[model samples]
Target: MANKLIKQMGLPKSIANIFTARNIITAKDALSHTEFELMELLDVDKEEVTSAMAHVSEVVCPPCQTALLLLEQRVRNETLAGHLPTHLKGLDEALCGGIPFGVLTELVGPAGIGKTQFCLKLSLLASLPASCGGLDGRVIYIDIESKFRSKRLIEIGINSFPEIFLKKGMAQEMAGRILVLRPTSLSEFAESLYQIKVSLLQQQVKLLIIDSMAALVLGEHECGTSRQQALGVHVSFIKSLAEFSRIPVILTNQVRSQFGDESRMYSFQEPLYNKR
Candidate 1:
């Protein structure tokens, strides 16, 4: 029966033998060859391809494993990952260490905690020369709060690299790399963000900033069923896009109050109100 099932599933005889010995219930329960199905089987979310190689004998494929090895190498190459500073030395150092290449890092805090400043600083930082943090990469700044300030960025840029502004050629080059985007509505904002991400990658954008994500959510509607649903969609959209781009997505968020508990006297709320 196992032999018949294995033949039907088109698996190699040697691979099928291993399953048959374990008395594997059926081929239906085994891994699939489709891309999505293979992704599910590998549990790429729970564990990385590199970690899986630690126990190569346990995994099901030689060809698939080889493909994963190549994929893993590519990811490692792109990541060129770095560490977060121990002192939390503001945004410059925190990101100076490096933001996860293909992950969403939320900057949630109170009104005056420098969230916008961080985003602006990151844009300028990414635009700097090799001597600075720049990888010859550009930045895409999405202004949701209507608080995108050019003056503030200029101030930070001057502080971080006075020589650039002092030198017209360098300043012109750095200024050209930044792309400021302002979307009037939530839908427009989302569409623009998607396009900007795609476009920026072509220009080798290492950093993308969405200033005050909650503003767009709250601007469209108050916290309600519709708003909740929309926010969820936005979160998922950003997460997916972040993974695809393999670039740092620094998003600012707003805060809200929460009800207090019986045991704890303090009443705190989640600053970043996204469902996840």
Candidate 2:
């Protein structure tokens, strides 16, 4: 099957022979090895390995659909599909329903502005039964700043949804659905995200909350450019994860007063991505 697909790709005969020699006779076999491994196995250069891998990925993966079809699907399933409401009436209205799925929704503010609190609320809400306007699925809360308090989450849950959370073991069950991960460094954070991507479906994740991306990026000891580049890569991976999982991702960020203007505050980490 892999040989047929590779031949259909019009790749050179040498590359085809390498696959045959290596016993890479299936798309899964071809994709199971990384590019570096494939290069070593096939004794081919990076370009040939890359081209072959790309062809295998395209052939094995799901077919790509048009944007119009995607839009139509979303429209047809809007009520059941995309958004996850915070269940905060005013905020929900202000947000045009709720935080949308398949994108990064940032909550930026000063230190005491309830960013983590809001995240906690969303976490509990996401774990509730779907009949109660929740996603009825698990949550992945990456607590970068160590701000996640299970006690506070319980307090909010009980206070907001007393009927649902007051039952014995109900709160425990809700808390069990939320997996909190704390990664002390940027590399560890990236690794955690990668692990989450691999376990997303199995874990039944409906929401992903990174409490303050700024903390991880700012804590990095690298110079500004390097930090920015690393941050960009991590951000792209996170966006990809959200889109691929079709889940709502909430990221918190801290704000600082503009250098020359105390009256105006902006995301402290914004400069890393947007330099004037």
Candidate 3:
């Protein structure tokens, strides 16, 4: 039965026999172990183990689909995997709606450029009802710089959507939907991310905003390669979270003038994974 199941997964007879010899009778049995454990148990190389695991996963829990099929599925579900509008007419039009879901959107500029304000507006919009041009979901705001103020957000909400904010108990209700976490150190920030992952499963989170990535890094580490490496890990994890949850993630970054040419400015520090 084990050999037959493995064969059905498109593995060769030799591979099936190896699994049987190792007492991995079912796909679940094989998948129960990590890739490294599988490699050691079956005495196969990394690629072989990876390929075998991919095959098993493909059969067990499939998510792959062609472009047309994905579109059809979205249509059937009546939920288009689209962007979340920022509600700024010019910016929304430039983005063809708004900040895209399942990707990282970075806001880089010098101090007092309204990055935090923009993020707060987005958080408010994300918490609003679908009828009010929102995702009708919650927001997880990782406020590294401690710049997230409830009062300011409420002001933005009042100005942007007076009809909704003017309603009785509406401001508190909207405020309840945005959960903020302030992690002072890098380690705490990473742990907060793990907690956010669990929260995502338990909540209808539509947007995530990290206000000022530069402050978090600069506060902990000095200017050097170590800072870049640490930031890269966090950025990669955040990217994965956005893709996994199928939500929009916004990150704000600070800028500094060039060393020689003070007229020109660039991001204070670029993450190692940053291509730009």
Candidate 4:
């Protein structure tokens, strides 16, 4: 009966036979083996590994194996998949026709550039009806520096969709769909990430906005530590989680003037983008 699950997944019979020969026990256990990892176990050549990968893709839905061809297909899928529109014509056009689902988009600028306002707008716009250009799904807003503005969210909602929210309690329902998190420091942000990993998927969070990604690491940089490297780890974790869950993460970052250069600026020493 366990073998039936493998067969139902559209994998070849020989692959199942190979697993049984190795005493792999069940398809669940066998599924964990990558094509490269399976070489020693199966005593197989590269061609056999390719064949195993093909079988693996049958059960994995999207293939776990990374190849140039697979990556091209993944990019194609991302472009074709439905995206969350920010509901502004020019901004949407600038953001590749709306924020692409399943990736991180960094909004970097100096102070007073409306990053928080944009985030608030996104949270409100994310919950509107599809006819009015919204995802109709919940949002996860991770605020740092005490900057998640609910009053602004309400104003944006009431202004953008007066007809919808005016119909009694719809405003609160819209507000309820936005799940807000205030993480004061780096450790708190990390803890919040763990708590939200499953919730994002289970609750169908369509958008994630991290206001001021640099806020948590500010103290570390002041103390002359490896704050850049540390920030990379944090951003990488958030990026992978966002990508894996197919949710678009909007991160707000603060810019710093390059030391001794006095001409150029960089975002968190380039670790946030370059390393990841």
Candidate 5:
């Protein structure tokens, strides 16, 4: 079956030279040229091809998947190796020696658990000078909950990367570059992210923050849909944005409460212990 597909695509048997033995027959080469050229070679609808790849790649040893995985890991490692230092001396060590780039890092917990404070401190640290422990990259704060406080940010910035705001003129300029977006609706929130992506591509921003995922989706709960569907859309949209922009997206999610009696706990425990 794989041989027939390869023959139909006009690919050569020498594909093995480019792919590993496990994946040589199970994948189509990604187009290296224009979209029209890709369409001509694949001879399939773009959406169909995307869906087919998503399904088949899960079950087969896909050449493209293997190659892409390696490429992503290589980029991640290189970025981590070259990452700038942070002011909080022990923070980097806590994170396995350095901040990672091109990958998402999730810091989750209940409210008032220092999630926002941690993000604020990290943003400031990200903007500091190399000598003073900073990455010198612009930060974009997406305040979906309207919780951003410029004064607080400045205070944290002063402590974490004081040199960045030492001069009035430089401070104002740096503040202007530290973009902030507080959207009132989901559409607006999503649009702001798209704008952020465009800005990043144009060298206007670097780091991104989406504080408290629950706040963004809580408004949608009034629509009365199933909880799973609501969460699915929210997660899917965020994932899509991350993949398309190839930027790190830090999204904080809320945990649901569990309520039951001691007997209920015992019932759950019994099932787990009985499994063995």
Candidate 6:
């Protein structure tokens, strides 16, 4: 757009074309271009480059600013400011409040670490009212290892909502809240990815739990590198769901230890993002 503005003001076509081709479509780029650099590209002297810049400056417009006012009451809502607590005070405080919304949380550890149990508890808690440390929304648990305990959820519902259980149709209603899905294989898991997104809005889900992400990745019959690529794909899909729906997505996984480590070889809690 900056280049087009300069072109409309009578800059030569060849010169304007070079702006985009050289990745200098912005006025800032034009301003930063060295006299020697412009000489090479424009076949002009330093004086001509300076003259061209003055013309470019006139076309370079600053972005306009806008402001908004939000209601005081809406600022403190559960979906935005507040987090979905696990209902365990110690655990919740340790996590600096609770499991937050609108992002993916990956939990990695070996077996018998209660990853599945913790997820089950969170799913049950997520169905509770906001005053009870929940988002008051539905849960979708994608089970890859067939460890989804429906009985556990029912027991929790009974204890958590005993009064609700006393009423007719409430037990069945509570049972329907936490939807369990067991994808038999990684390929099958991939097929259900799209439908899960649709279910989030339709069912009004705000918390998603995937029990053991490793099962789907490691179960694939392919090279180790291929498994890594598959993991990337799975991460991308879940990330899209979290960001688009503005909900918390928790995924558990297992890690392997390398044998040939002489001294702290397999250690890493690296930053999630880095330059390639």
TM-score winner: 6
Q: Report the Cα lDDT for residue 145, model 3.
A: 77
Question: Which stretches in model 6 have alpha-carbon errors above 4 Å?
Answer: 1-37, 46-81, 158-169, 257-276
TM-score versus the correct structure, for each prediction: 0.63, 0.66, 0.67, 0.67, 0.61, 0.69
Give the alpha carbon lDDT tens digit for every residue of 94-212 in model 6: 55467766667777666778888888778877776666555678988898888887787777667766765557876666567888888888877877778899998998897898886
lDDT of each: 0.61, 0.79, 0.80, 0.73, 0.55, 0.69
In candidate 3, what residue range of length 10 has the lowest lDDT sum? 267-276
Q: Clashing pairs in model 4? A: none
Using TM-score as the yardstick, the better of models 5 and 6 is 6
- Better by lDDT, candidate 4 or 2: 2
> Which regions in candidate 3 have their CA more than 4 angstroms from the true location?
1-80, 257-276
Let me know the TM-score candidate 4 reaches against the reference structure: 0.67
Scored by Cα lDDT, where does model 2 land? 0.79
Model 6, total clashes: 1
lDDT of 5 by residue, 115-140 (tens): 78777766666655446556566788
Over 4 Å off in model 2, which ranges?
1-80, 257-276
Candidate 5: stretches off by over 4 Å: 1-86, 129-132, 222-227, 243-246, 256-276
Candidate 1 structure quality by residue, lDDT tens digits, 39-107? 355444434323322233233333444756765664465347532221235633434445556667777
Q: Which ten residues in a row have the lowest lDDT in candidate 2?
A: 267-276
Tens-digit lDDT track for model 2 on 1-276? 444445555557888777878787667678779999988999989998898888777766677889778766654544355688888788767555677777677777778988899999999989998998898999999998898999999999989999999999999999999999999988789889889997788989999999877678877744657766776788778878877998988877776554476643323223221111
